[model samples]
Target: MRRPAFHTRLRAHASACGGSSLIEVMLAVALVAVSALGLIAAQVWTAREARAMSLRESATWIADSIAEATRTPSVGNAALNQWSAWASVLLPHGDASVGESGAVAAARVTWASVRDRPTAGDGIGPSAEPCGGVDAPAGSSCVALAFAQ
Candidate 1:
């Protein structure tokens, strides 16, 4: 057979060197892997943020439900200190010793999940003695009123 021409030899030589360098190929693969991992991390963070926001909204809605329950006539002995939701109500019982405890002035709120989860001493049961837990000295009859969430 006739020997190959000069042009064919040059073309073959260029082809032998034309493919990707090993280091360059490996670097490209690593870059793509890193970008994929970053996208996954971003997705996870977004899901976590969304879950936290949803929990906060649920807590606020539970509080609103308790307030609305107080407005209903069926809420027995209900007041700002004794409002009841369809599920539960939080009542306060501050130690009369603390004269200016800010906790008494605020509603004693428990998440609905607390009741649903059923912990050791938690449920949709009697919370506290509602009436006599208000701003009274101890037995001054402050109408025994407060509210819950």
Candidate 2:
């Protein structure tokens, strides 16, 4: 028997390997799609965490400002009201308060997190109050600082 021609052998090999290329292409697409989805999820999570951190930083600043104002006897109710108004402008559903007990004074700033409204707390972390021992309001986060007079 005569062996097949080189061209014929090549044709047979190509036909046999054709389906594998299609399968390989499909698998490659699938892998790329899965990787893209994972990256998109990571981007979303990063954006959410960034927003949360920004809100936390704003709350801290407001709390610190209130604490500083409390140190001055000349800064009275008007100044406190202004700070509270500022907080409301800086954060969603924001509020600020100052409390004094004995020789210690505390400043607290609270705001509702847009992503945590339905859950009633910071959903990303352990379910704990942000304002030290005090429980923050439902759906809200807080920053509190205490100083001795």
Candidate 3:
């Protein structure tokens, strides 16, 4: 049985490169799992920020709509109520308020969400809003307009 010189070299190389140990494989898997978990966390944060931005955009739209309607004689508390109802339906614990004094008007919308995955609404969550509810942090969006005298 005469094996080729190359066969002997191959056997020596295989012995030298005995693949990964159990600990090495475990460590590699742990690192991969950690990286995946970090990626997932970042995705979750992005989703939350996206949702908050959407709510802010919607609030701006609602404020603009209310301001436009404010010109009509029939627009007042009823319009605010309708918009409040609409906002409530659109966002969790959503509320809308409109205030007018003389020639100035202000519209604000507030909502709640667990943007930072806080165990509780500790008043220190990321971008905490003054209008949030009990279980989540609050966020507010507002706009003000003045009519010509």
Candidate 4:
């Protein structure tokens, strides 16, 4: 019997392999989609962290300002209130307070932070006071500075 021509054999092989290319393409597309989703999640997390950091930096600056004002005898409660007002304007539900414990004075800045989600068993929530024992609201973050009297 005469053997089939090369073109015929190639055609037979191509027909046999028909659906495999489609499957491979589908798998590749799925992989790319999953990777893209992961990248997008990372970007979102990064943006949230950047915003949280910016808020923390602002809190720190406010705390430092409080400390400076405390050191200066001329600076009064009005100045401190102004700083608190500034914090409120700059951060979400922000507040600042100055407290004295014995010889050490503390400046506490508190704000509601998007990143302050309550984790499991951490016991951190609205009532949890993390900033030098100051009463921070729910889902809030704080920055505290202690300076000598």
Clashes of each: 5, 0, 2, 1
Candidate closest to the true structure, highest lDDT: 4
Ranking by lDDT: 4, 2, 3, 1
Better of 1 and 3 by lDDT: 3
lDDT (Cα, tens digit) per residue for candidate 2, span 45-85: 89999998998899889888888887877884677798899
lDDT for model 2: 0.82
TM-score for each of the candidates? 0.44, 0.83, 0.68, 0.86
**What residue runs in model 3 are displaced by over 4 Å at the alpha carbon?**
18-31, 117-149
lDDT of 3 at 146: 38
How well does candidate 3 match the true structure, expressed as C-alpha RMSD?
Answer: 4.9
The residue-by-residue lDDT of candidate 3 on 60-136, one tens digit each, is 77767666766676776678778889888887677776665666656666666544454335655455433222222
Global lDDT of model 4: 0.85
List candidate 4 segments past 4 Å from native: 1-6, 119-127
Which residue pairs overlap in candidate 1's backbone?
Answer: 80-146, 80-147, 81-146, 81-147, 131-144
Candidate 3 lDDT for residue 36: 100
lDDT of each: 0.44, 0.82, 0.66, 0.85
Encode model 4's per-residue lDDT on 1-149: one tens digit a residue.
Answer: 77669978899999999799999999999999999999999999999899989999999999999998888767758779899999999988999999889989899999876654665357653456566766665567899999986
The candidate scoring highest on TM-score is 4
